[model samples]
Target chain A: MHPRLTLALTLIEAVAILAYAISGFIEARKRRLDAVGTFLVGFATAFGGGTVRDVLLEHRPFYWVEHQTYVIVLFVASLFAPFVLRTLSRLFSERALLVADAIGLGLFSISGTSIALEAGMPAFTATLMGVATGVFGGLIRDVLCNVVPLILRDSRPYATCAFAGCWLYLLLDHFDVDSVYSLIIATAFILIARLVTFKLNVRLPH
Target chain B: MHPRLTLALTLIEAVAILAYAISGFIEARKRRLDAVGTFLVGFATAFGGGTVRDVLLEHRPFYWVEHQTYVIVLFVASLFAPFVLRTLSRLFSERALLVADAIGLGLFSISGTSIALEAGMPAFTATLMGVATGVFGGLIRDVLCNVVPLILRDSRPYATCAFAGCWLYLLLDHFDVDSVYSLIIATAFILIARLVTFKLNVRLPH
Candidate 1:
């Protein structure tokens, strides 16, 4: 495994934990769910993607076991988000969700690709797994929140961004690029692709 | 597999397909989803567990490939379900869901355990895989639907039923019991145990 890539994945994991935790809290408020319900939704959203990947790979002890702090962080963030994010959303002209979601897509895609490479899967499968890992958490979050999946719908470029970014990462690595350079380049592709798609209202029909 | 056990498992699979398909379709309607959405949800509910099991085991072609009828049946059923199941649910109650889920659990647990044993996995690991095959589908579906997962929630016999039934099936098979007898016995154990838990509102706390 590439050490720099591992560090990058950890950073992305932290970002995702924070973003999903906030989103979960916001959705819970929209549904008028109780505190327990809010925390549970947040918790699922935070862990859903990585958990699925770990299970698929037969990775023992699971990633969450080694990093229990992420859970504790999400718990605290969710508790505070309702007070901060909800109020800010009412006042800000910009949409916080779109940016946060884009960042999350980038982070998750990068993390997923790295993990797949670590497991020694081929590039094609690694790209698919990466995109799946990035988007699956949100897929699950939407389902539990009683909404349609963002990925299956022609709603936006959510998964496409992940796919594109992962491929770019893999392509660069094939050329034996520097790890940090590849990480930045790949993550930028995801972030930019997602943001551009969202801004232009792009959607995939199939 | 015992010839007789195979037959019993077939019956259980059919019943499970119908039950989960109905539940999936019902959830789709509640969300006002399109026909595609309805069908996808139904398919996931019916075959998601087995698919996950096959993927984990690196089994080629997957279960649905051999049993293409299962997918077709769910597809056809989804179109008519919104109308048919409402009337049916009124009479049968959610008990149908429980019974069907239990049947699937029993069959899947047996298949998973037997496969793992064949592969020479340790008994503990084999048992875990068996439980996963039986229960992981619902967990995946719940995540997709964005609802608190039934398995992880502190309020259900859920995975416990699968876990218990897998061991029972293993013990019976170890004794070279008649395949048909083991199938029937294991299925009954899961179904009765599951139904009783539901009627009594049994659940484990986190």
Candidate 2:
């Protein structure tokens, strides 16, 4: 991979991790889970998808396991989540959740696709894995909360954006595009598509 | 992996997979899911735990993927599930569910531990993975059905049985017991314990 693309992915990963952890924290609080449950849910939300992808691709020691600092960061963040949530509740709104989810989806989807491609998966499987990596964390969290998975039931174009973005990335890569450009363009497309879907109330038939 | 032990595991695995799939089919029908959803949930319940285990241990070409017959069997069974379920509604009762669940828990718990040991995991991690493999299929199914996991909140000796059984297997192995005997004793213990717990109305205080 290009050095610049690696750097870009690293940066996107950081943001995605934080966004997903916060999303988990919020869901944990809503479910009235204790601190331990909060941390477990937050940790799962941050790392579950990539872990599954890595496992599927026969990548050992998982991404988080390889990056100890990520685990520590999530642990410390989870320790402070309840206090931080209390302070943010007055200012936080659904918009924050929406934005965070969109950004995380885009970044994780691109990263997941890149990993699958590197692992020599076919385009369809790679794209499917990308969408799965973007969505399964929330699926796990909702399962923990005993709710029908939002991606499965909701009409919104959640996994669809990830799927489309992955195809764009695959298409660009097929045409000899630079890795860095492909990553950026695909991520941006997913982000914009997600937000646009929300703005336009775009939905699949339920 | 002795030949006898391998044969035992293969037979046990077949039973566990079938039992878990049936459990999933019942849950999907109860929820009124369509055929696709029924198959998805059934597949997940049958394979989800072992998939997670193999991925964690860096085992490539998952068991079901390696043995395509299992997938075919699950697919065919799923196609017939709604019909079979309606006909068996009178024949299938809670007792069958409990018995199937107990047998699955016992067999999967031992198999998971064996795999983890073969993968060179520490005893504690191996034991934990064993219990996880035993219970996670049910966890996935319940999550899909929008219910709190039985292991997490039912106050029953669900995961407790698996955990205890894994430890027994670990201890027997530690004592240099024959592999076949250790597997048999441990699995029997879990099955009996689970059934006894239900029969006696034994539950942990919530």
Compare the candidates by lDDT and give the number of the best one.
Answer: 2
**DockQ of each two-chain model:** 0.13, 0.16
> Model 1 scores what on Cα lDDT?
0.72
DockQ, candidate 1, comes to 0.13
| Decoy 2 TM-score against native | 0.60
Q: Quote the lDDT for A16 in model 2.
A: 77
On a 0 to 100 scale, what is the lDDT of residue B46 in model 2? 88
Q: Write the residue-wise lDDT of candidate 2 on B85-188 in tens digits.
A: 77656777868767867889998899899999999999999999998888888888887989877679888898899899999999999899988789889999
How well is each residue in B16-70 modelled by candidate 1, as lDDT tens digits?
7677667677776665555545666676776777777667677654465556677
lDDT of 2: 0.82
| Alpha-carbon interface RMSD for all candidates, in angstroms | 6.6, 4.7
Each prediction's RMSD to truth: 8.6, 6.9
What fraction of the true interface contacts does model 2 reproduce?
Answer: 0.24
